[model samples]
Target: MIAFLTSCQEELDLDNPNAFSLEELLQTADGFELLAVGVMDSYQKIPANEFLLIDLRSDDSRANAQNGVYPDVDAYNMDTNNGDAATYWSNNYATIFRANSIIDNRFLAPEEYQYTIGEAYFFRALCHFNLVRAYRNVPYLDKVIDINSNEASNYPQLPPSEVYEKIIQDFRTSIAFLNGGPQNRYRPSEGAAICLLAKAFLSQPNPNYTEAELLLASVIENKESFGYDLLTIDRDDAVNFLFDADPNDPTVNVLTTEEYRANQAITFAKIFGNEFTGEFSSDNLRLDGTFSNNEGLEINEEIIFSIPYEAINTDNVASSQSGLDDQVETDAEGFSNAMTASGPSNGVNVATLDLLSLMTPELQPVRFDGTFRSITVIADDILNDTFNSKYHLLGKPMGTIGLF
Candidate 1:
């Protein structure tokens, strides 16, 4: 009885050295926000592999080389155990797990931290939705798996419909809590929730066009309040899109700044603007005065949700920062020096000849641009941005949003 009483008085309060107390971290002032930022940052790491699956499968692109996992994904011969499949699956789920942690302990956060919790829900919902779409029947993990608890081995591999239900549920939670504009363009807002919810509603089994329509309308009507707008180009500020050996040639037929600045002309030129021109006079990037008044760039208004890269140039500058993105942070001093050091190109996956003719002069939906899909900067080098078209299914879910 004495020994038992002595044992009862002892307490063990040892801190974990090998594991992070993510729950405790969530309770800190900036911890919830960092959790949100980490989720967003992880998204940036996915584009490379994500592009491979969507792009190479399409008629537009082919394997860069016959080696590595490229050929496997290119030919649709990827097994579940394949390197590419495993990599993509692992990366996405990592983000999902982080989100699950935030959601599992909702009470730990104060009422003031709703926005942080909302972002987690939004990210979690998005991660699950994409996994359902890509992997079909996948293991939907609601909470972090306990290795010692046998839960890891017995995860529920449910159908995509069930997955959709999970996604919609999380989205409802996100919409309820995700208020304010955004922490940044990368972060989700109420409008982001609405946009994604509409997409989710449209993607379900029977589909819910009415609900999708209403949600999309709410986002579209109040987009300005959410900090979204169409970008404009001034006729005087537009750059000439021609490879004229002789600048003096008058009769030579070439597209000019005047034509590109017109309401009807394609805005595709924005992708291949003078960001690579090492000169201070270049970088027609309008991003809140990152460059000098002489540089001509004013700011970017059209981009609603583009991931940003660092402006401090290392090996990767704006051009080297893969496929398509803006330097959302305005530290252009490194950018200018990086440009001057190496006049690198922003080239990406090559498009098919047929595909080029398709989107060259202007963008899609004939109501928007009937003529050209792109402008010829040089004979063979028509400037273009490589958006994965195989992900057309992604756009297909937006059936009503585009029309409205």
Candidate 2:
């Protein structure tokens, strides 16, 4: 465990569990790139830790009942403590810690401070943004304070709105430091900072959608220069997107800033964006198993963000179904849904039919399936038709919110 302890003002001695200091590291230009690497680590760690998060809000879970992933989203449920919140919080703070140490140094001994600080600010903002979105409130690291200090100990989680304010401040500061600098393949620069700032402002409650749309558009326009593209797993091409990449190779382009900024296909497809696989069984129909219709579309170019599942390397596939069959028994009294009866990889996280019906009502009409036929429909008929026409749905149920 690294600890930031007493050190000389000339040298910001970083107590890294790893064997190097930021000053010694900055001797090489590559050291400047550590900011980017730290961000990558923070992002990837989200899905790697089993207890981090369960995306109950996933498409698969929201589409069926028996397969409902969480059954409940209440914080104290068995699922809440699974590790999503804790891991995400830990990783984000870890990145912030690194950034704080670097920024605290008064000397601009290295050429990379501008770039590194910008990246650090961006990451700090990014972490806070995600934390707010997932957990609603979290502790804000307001100053450069020791992690071991009593101050750190007594801090309480702040409101989401305040977190957004700090995020905006951080991004603005980062942008100023970067000074409209050109972007790098793997690092945050002026453009990335601007894009993130736009995102942070727009994502907060009561968003300024006008600015958000414009920022998103800019990201779309500069995607290539920013080193992002909607990754297509060409069936004709030999490599699969996830497992084929050497995990340890730091230089690999796993995802790009442009894709992230644009909310492109990859961003929308995030089963768990940073995790290596979508939280689904690789062999189940959603991709390779029973849900062939959706899975076929999922693995194709339309999918913007997905981690591949490799049954061969159990650890490598962040989500898999190797041992679930025995856990859920099927019998006359048991739920006879597709998920439990199928297999471990095939367990269902069913979403209410209402959601699917909202997307495409004609396809799933009343009495379409004996068990699935709508029991009741409530809502103003006129408004329903208007929304249906706008979204291209025939009808929708009242009070419908999807679960993954």
Candidate 3:
């Protein structure tokens, strides 16, 4: 009986190195979900250079804070050959690597894993979309790489248009493969692929707005499936709902009560009085309503997707310790909460002024009572708007945008 049992176990195919049968993984889950996770992970794992490119080019984060090696508080024209160029060139390649790895691997999953294939298509397309946007030209590898002869270095860059063709195809395939389910949401659902497809087409210098319009329409129609929408709550109301109000005596150099109250009465309210209520605050209504307090903002019925910050993989603080030459010149430990948290514990890295300026729009809802007296010289009303505007862009007016 023992011999029979042992033989049965051996015949069960339980010891395959590939989790599922080699044939099942290739046929079942495929590589979609793996690729999707890779695309998502790339955003968080971006290096300082790539971060600079996106942040500098982005609308609000350009003027105030930054993490670049150089602190250019002023509006200096960026040359593609300068530091900005290096950032653009490096980050897109990294994204490509993640996408490529999945395409080249065997995704082992049970035959029942149908959604897996859809996710892989979505991620590969997402990576290409981002790459084409940043680099203008990138390699489009549809087939698995040959381990024997072909190396990454041997691969050549394709024209941006060619890359776009592959990107569009991947997204469309993703939409078709995914049968619209919530399980897909945690990964890059059809919704994310559609969003990416629309973005990819739009980024073209001479875009086909008709196609873009159609894609966006699909996004709206199936919005509920993917869970994308705006939060209706006032910024302050949402904050109150999310955090516990543990009003501690203001930190040693914190804003004074009189100042806090006066500022709170203005158009904006103070952000510090209320503590985190276990809700994520990453995508607040700052710039285009995408900015948030914590790395992952969870506003009411809104939020299509939110990326959680992993402390270890997060961009590191190069200069938090005293006497570090590269540390930001701020007398205060750190300016932004992200920097502040990293500074004392790990190390602090300042967000670039270029990113601050790029993300800054003309209007926003801000925490009023939380003014930095040390940073602003003007009246609260004038500075209030500036403060709110800056915060909305994920920055602080510790120094004027023009200070650069």
Highest-lDDT candidate: 1
If the candidates were sorted by their TM-score against the true structure, best first, what order would they fall in?
1, 3, 2
Whole-structure CA lDDT of model 1: 0.53
List model 3 lDDT by residue over 57-97, tens digit each: 44433334343432352244565457545544554455555
What's model 1's TM-score? 0.65
Stretches off by above 4 angstroms in model 3 are: 1-43, 47-49, 63-68, 71-95, 104-109, 146-154, 183-186, 233-302, 311-404
What digit string (tens of lDDT, one per residue) describes model 2 on residues 231-259?
43332332233332337795564432222
The alpha-carbon root-mean-square deviation between model 1 and the true structure, to one decimal in Å, is: 11.0
Off by over 4 Å in 2: 1-18, 26-29, 48-54, 57-82, 106-109, 176-192, 220-352, 359-404
Q: What's the distance in Å from true for residue 302, model 3?
A: 4.2
Assess candidate 3 and give its lDDT: 0.44
Q: TM-scores of the models, in the given order? A: 0.65, 0.51, 0.54
Positional deviation of 241 in candidate 1, in angstroms?
12
What C-alpha lDDT does candidate 2 achieve relative to the native structure?
0.44
Candidate 2, residue 266: the lDDT equals: 27
What's the residue-level lDDT of 297 in candidate 3?
A: 30
Superior by lDDT: candidate 1 or candidate 2: 1
lDDT of 1 by residue, 65-149 (tens): 4346665676788876776566667767888877877788777777777787888888788877767777789987777777467
